[model samples]
Target: MSKSATIYRMVMDGHICPWGLKSLHVLRSNGFAVDDRWLATRSETDAFKEQHGVTTTPQVFIDGQRIGGHDDLLRYLGKPVRDPEALTYAPVVAIFAMAAFMALAAHWVVAGTLFSVLAAEWFIAFSMCLLALQKLRDVESFATQFLGYDLLAQRWVPYARLYPWLEGLAGVLMIAGALHWLSVPVALFIGSIGAVSVFYAVYIQKRELKCACVGGNSNVPLGFVSLTENLMMIAMALWMVAKPQLL
Candidate 1:
């Protein structure tokens, strides 16, 4: 004889009937067809209670297997019951550091102190820019290693090292003020570049790509954290450009 298809059984008092109804809705939503006949108390099967040792209403059985009660069902749905508030200390630190540096730059400019504080700001900004570009280099290096491709061996690609070189050069120009009018544009350009890099990192994570950012310390999903950091950096760069008197 062919074995009968196992029917799901649920029992609930009127007070807890809504939970069963909601579970039925979810079952239907997930494309599982359920017979409500098993829900009727008058004709319900005692076979389930005898086999599974269930002594409670709101008990559930699927395919002859006990699935537990209402609370257990909700827990099985994988919905987040609680989430911790996110922290943002890194971005906060970057903002305060930039603000302090700018204040010192402003003081030096006002006092007509030639080439001390201004040079310091230039060097600091340059260091930050280089660090950001280094992140890009690390990404490229990782891709090559993972893909096992000799990118430099192919002349058509030629390793694409020019972009980082240009970034470093831009840092130099920001320091030298090659064209006094170009300082703002350079700062804006550098800021724009960093913003794009950070955003691209976020985009990759959203697409479920493994992040090569910060050498594997950035395994966390991209969200408000990356966005805030990028925005802060862009703001700092713009502030430096618009008010050159504050470096």
Candidate 2:
């Protein structure tokens, strides 16, 4: 005899609640025989909400005890609840992972090979452009956060504002394999400053702060990941200058 659960979710001709679907999936995956109840129309959904005193749909009941929505269900099952505002490295990790994947794919598409020295170059360039785009979404916010610890940004406020654009442009040019004259110098300059600033702030001053690497509204902590971005740019810039001659 499997455990029995009842779920009330919205399902209409024109619209379906995604959370409702997720709840149903979770219930089934947990080995529950679910009595899936549907609120087929807005009026019915409203009526259900009024009757149950819940503002949202996909309410679950297990063994006659009411469990709230998705988050509530997770809690009931002793699972970790999702917290969007918590400090996390998820954004940077995702960007780096995707950039590496795309770099390999791009190299394969262009050069008819799955692996190459060039893929590493593309990975850094792609990561830089993506990270810059995140900062570009709210330049003012990013600048304010950046000014907290960047040595050059502390002395010159305008550099904080201009950093994202420089990074983006350099990354774009590097990806295109054009304007080595411009991109190489830009990457080297910013990367050098950023590396030094991060090193001093984190290692020397030993200050803990939020990184503006992801964006202005980012919750990522400043440390190894932030330093890695600058180090990658410096190495990439040096490679751009040297690879041409060595190849």
Candidate 3:
């Protein structure tokens, strides 16, 4: 015999509960024949909640065993739940992935090619802008975190605050293929300082720290990832100077 479950969920004209849909989908995906009970109005939902002695809807029952809401349902199935407070590299990874996609898409549209010297440049520039935006979202927070390990930022408070703006401006100028004289110098100066700072803090000092590369609220561990960001900037700066000569 097949497993069976019943779910009481909110389904109204103006609003639909996403948790309810998730619950239904989970049950069906797990090979359960679900008896979906839709609470169509405010009164109906309230009445159901009162009858069941529960505060929330999207309640699931399997063989008279109550499986609470979406989170509870996942627990019942022995699934790993996401912890929002946990430290993760997800933000940085997502930004890089998005930058790569955007670079490829822009190159395809303009150059009728998937790969080129210009596309590679676009990828790095786009990543720099996106990463800078994350830090700029809350400059004070970013600066505080940055000062913890960044050598230059610790000595010069204003540099900590202005770093994101400088990074973003250089990226924009590079992308526009304008003001190479300004962009190249900015990228090189900051990138060299950042690389030296990160290398000393993480490798030489062997001190563990959080990366300010993503933002102030970032949970990404400082080390390889932070070093990579600076190195890429340095490479891009040098490339900007040499590319014209080669092409």
Best by TM-score: 2
Tens digits of per-residue lDDT for model 2, 18-82: 99999899889999999999999999999999998989988999999999898899889888897
> In model 1, which runs have C-alpha deviations exceeding 4 angstroms?
1-139, 142-160, 175-183, 193-205, 208-233, 244-247
TM-score of each model, paired residue for residue: 0.33, 0.85, 0.82
Scanning candidate 1 in windows of ten residues, the lowest lDDT window is: 145-154
By TM-score, how accurate is candidate 1?
A: 0.33
lDDT of 1 by residue, 105-201 (tens): 7547766653554555564455545434544656556333212212232333433333344344555665565653554454455446545544554
Q: What C-alpha lDDT do the candidate models reach, one value each?
A: 0.47, 0.93, 0.94
Query: Candidate 2: where are CA atoms >4 Å away?
Result: 10-16, 39-50, 53-56, 244-247
Model 3 segments more than 4 A misplaced: 9-16, 37-58
